[model samples]
Target: MRVLLLDNRDSFTRNLEHLLVAAAGADVTISAHPQAADVAAQRWDLVVISPGPGRPCDHPGYGPWIDGGTPLLGVCLGMQILNEHFGGTTEPLPGCVHGRAEPVEFLGRTLRVARYHSLHAATVGSGLEVLARTRSGIVMALRHTERPLLGFQFHPESFLTEDGGSLVHSALCLLGLR
Candidate 1:
């Protein structure tokens, strides 16, 4: 299977590549271009759009990939992009959530996981499904109703969460990535 890891940061890009490759024997490729159009042009079975610290909707070029037919797996900032670009809203979320291992709530229960992000605003678009939620009422996971797009607010590469690796592995299974 083939996957594309798109990100401006080289370190995050490489780490994701390694994770997917190790998880499913996927042929992972990394792209450091900040231009969303360039990343959209590539053909990929799965696109792991890395979370950028900035607002992703600020770029008009990003629309194609998210709305286009690319099966995407969003992480962190990428999750925010999924919300913002698809008719959802993103404002400053209350409190800071930064740690490798933290107890977060989802569906009335706390799940120990790693959280690393500044923004947490969420509301799935018109037809999006929120697959998971955090104790703070933050949407932690989402999926497009008619496509293979998926989003997760946490970083699986961080050593904090107990099943960070498993979370990523589950993403691959959802997309039939292997």
Candidate 2:
């Protein structure tokens, strides 16, 4: 599969890139947070938004890509960006979680996923369905009801997560790429 991996100045982008190749067998191209026009000019089978530090509002120029009808996978802050694009809100997580593993029910199974964030989705946007969440009700996974968009609040490429490759594979299946 042809994939466009958008880097948001995040540290885990390289790990994500490897996972996309090893797990999804994707031909990946890395873009360092390119402008909307640059992204719109390319032809991609999928666009993977990398995790970044800061609130969703901190990263603009993604609205056009999110609304362009292409399949997208957003991680961490990227997920927040997706939520904000659809009118959802983000707030600081009470205790803030970073460099930790949390258990959540995903894809009909219990999985421990790595989390590194201080903010989470406060209210999911319209037409987006919450697929999974932490015990504390933090949105862990979401999918647009009528669009080819998916978001993961945790880092699927982190070593702390079990079966990270499987998670990536499942995401590909969910997005109809597998």
Candidate 3:
């Protein structure tokens, strides 16, 4: 599958790329500076938004892909971007999890995932469904109601996440590429 990896200059970007290629059998393209229009001009089966350091609101270039009908998977800051684009809100967490494994309820099943973000989704807007959350009630994952878009608050590409491959595979399945 042809996958576009919109990198936000996160340190784990290379690892994420390797995982996508090795595990998902995807032809991955890395873009350091992604613009919505430029991205829309190309053909991509899936778009994976990599985790970054700043607020997703700060970079508005990704707004074009939110409703473009292609499957999208957002990680960490990418999740916040998806949330904000869909009218949701984000806030600073009371406690930050740096390379810590926490139990998260995902689609009714609990799994340990690596957490690294300082901000979490505070409120999800209309047409979006919460798929996972931490024990303390922080939103850990979400999916679009009417679109094939998913977001994860945790870093699934990191080695810290034990089921990271499975999570990524699930997203590939969502795109019907598996």
lDDT (10s digit) by residue, model 1, range 72-170: 898878877777777887766677677656665543446676777667755567777887777557777787787788888877766566655667777
| Model 2 residue pairs with clashes | none
TM-scores, each model vs. reference: 0.84, 0.97, 0.93
Q: Where is the poorest 10-residue window by lDDT in model 3?
A: 169-178
Residue pairs clashing in model 1 are: 100-160, 105-134, 105-135
Per-residue lDDT tens digits for candidate 3, residues 6-90, read: 9898998888898888778889989887784565589999998889897877767887777778899988988899999888998
- By the lDDT metric, which is better: model 1 or model 2? 2
Per-model lDDT: 0.70, 0.91, 0.83
Q: Order of all candidates by lDDT, from best down to worst? A: 2, 3, 1
Report the Cα lDDT for residue 105, model 3.
71
